[model samples]
Target: MSLPQPVPPSWKDLGKSSNDLLSKDFPFQGFALEVKTKTPSGVAFKVAGNRDAKSDTINGDIEAKWSDRKHGVTITNTWTTSNILRSQVELENQIAQGLKLDVTSSLHPDKSTKTALINAIYKQSGFHTRGALDIFKGPTFTADTVIGRDGFLVGAEAAYNVTEGNVTRYAAAVGYNAPEYAITLHGLNNLKTFTASYYHRVSSDVEAGAKAVYDSKSTHGGVGIEVGAKAYLDQAAFVKAKINNAGVVALGYTQTLRPGVKASFGLALDTTKLNEVAPVGPSHKIGLNLVFDS
Candidate 1:
């Protein structure tokens, strides 16, 4: 008889569901748009722009990508209005099965600054691991790994500064994932902060999540809590709402306007300032986003 194969979880995706529920679709002081298309020669291009309401700054970037599936190689380049150029190249399943390699670099035209990094990832039935090294700057080294069996997962990550000859950061996480729900606990910021998160798929169209954070080094030294939920009204529209311990409430609505177009609206309000005769600044914030893809 053959035993059931184990599944390895991604270290970076430990609390992704809970994090997305509590953070995604929240309002910001900006308006952004993105358009994506592909060329006949198999090159993909994306143009993105953002307008900051507070700073009155308009920033944008243009990105292009080319992939060769036969050779298992992909290359991408992005140029930003801030005079920064970034590039990344990836190779998958070339050296060995379940192995991937990536090289990324960034250059600043005005400052004449350049930085590069190389990363490697390997994954198998029950194990996953990743490592990265900075070729410039402090020449830091970072690594993380996760192992899972029977829906239980454990992972750890650390980073070391080569120039300083010290371990700059370290963290650990444990999680359990089931068909209906997932729970995770994480020790972050070198163990100075801890967080617990839970996510549940209540029904076909309803999902809920919550997160609690405790900072040992904070002045308040108390646990902060946040809860959020998302519900799909129909095939073309959805709504999200969340509240935090500080009496801040946020709501978001998204709808598909057309076959290739979508729009999202967000609003945030401070309940604590409702009694104040006149709030010092804006007591509410709003955000809008639109996207087009072809």
Candidate 2:
């Protein structure tokens, strides 16, 4: 017989993250199986409990995947009663696709709204883990972008980072668009969150951005403000650096190959200093990444 795997150390401290990161661009080799409710019914079995005992059932789950920058992005939107489709469209419409005016109207006018639904289940449901410091890491960046006329600019950069990717294992994605301000969301754990970020290009050869994720569950979601910068290298490779948890910092180098492939190596200390933020741990994680064109 097997018992449930206990969540790792310091679980209650981490917040819910999305499974998207696991599928988009990660560099790791492993297999996973997710069990979801199907008909809400299970094989009948005898019970030792009293007649008042309620019947238990098992539901089936859809399989998830793990992708990296080396491959391409895999769009895995399931249709569980059509609501899934609606939600996906809603999210896509909201993403800030730096498109021109002619293209913007053709697509959905983008506006990141702060709604109750967005507040509750934007990307909340997924496998749960308990750990000292779970991480939902990824390298999600698009190669060639489809362009429109005016308002429709670039599709929301389908990439994931410490808090931007899918936030699957360790966090809620600190996501946003330039225009969108005052971001907010509520977790199933009854915890609330807020995030904001901005990007600017210096000399067209170098670009930089900064973002933060705050978890009401603790004194703060991340150790503190998460900041990073990216610089392009001959259109193939780029370098980046960041600091978080009000202390720990990191630096990384990434490269793109052909058009559909990407890879990178990162080094850091205390990477994600959850609350109480400890000293920076080891300072390096060599990652082989890949992402496919969806």
Candidate 3:
């Protein structure tokens, strides 16, 4: 028999019941399973399909790793309906002087695309900085940089649209963090849009957050705000909700059924369109997850 995993009381701290976790859409609606096992040198990973009720298809990935204290290497393969779809390999190492470096390559058989990425990060004097480079089959290149410290973090990223053969978009963000809360300001596409968010833990079991967003190109062309809250009903269950100035509302509940088993339900509504000529109906979703250690 599997031992019962003791559930913790700090739901808000874990973001388990947090509505602010999602930026643009409702929570996922599917079932997933994962199993991990310890090897002599590293670990093995298996992730089963994130099965959706609407679709009867199943997919999964398997991975193996070899590692020690300083470095590791991993390889993975993914399959769907008996068809091998993708493969990926990665290598990472912590070099002398506290520098960490990693390289990854991936191939998608169905898409006829391949990608390679290299990155490095280093830390000193309580400061951290990192950079990355990506190359895809279209000969496209992208670069990113990030720097951060305890209470402050910032980053900038730009991507080359390989398919479009153009450098199209860029983004940046700055944030301040504390033990009880965090706030962030961000911009995308050279300030074509902006967003600001703040989150605070009201207590050990409850948390609240709000976000304000602006898009110069939107129909409204005005700032919109969203407020969210999460509360732990007990160690085994929790609920979360969010409301936005656009008259959109979302609510979710999660419950831990047993060790390695969990479930969730979600509902979303658009109050502004409830009684319109072409009424938009409410939406509901459900999900289940199972995890195991072999």
The top-ranked prediction according to lDDT is 1
Pick the TM-score winner.
1
**Model 1: how far is 20 from its true place, Å?**
1.2
Write down the RMSD of all candidates, one decimal each. Answer: 2.0, 20.7, 8.3
How do the residues 128-237 of candidate 3 rate in per-residue lDDT, one tens digit apiece?
A: 45555666544555555545455566666676766777876677777766778877777877678987888888998998888888998898688989888888999988
lDDT values of the candidates? 0.90, 0.32, 0.62
Cα lDDT tens digits, model 2, 1-294, are 544333121122221121111112222121212222222232111111111111222222232222222322222223221122211112221333311111000111243321111111111112222111112113322211122222122111122243464533222322222222212121222225454444555545665555555567775345345555656677787777666555655666667766654565544445444443222223222333333322
The C-alpha TM-scores of every prediction are 0.95, 0.34, 0.72
**Model 1, 283: alpha-carbon shift in Å?**
3.5
For candidate 2, the TM-score is: 0.34
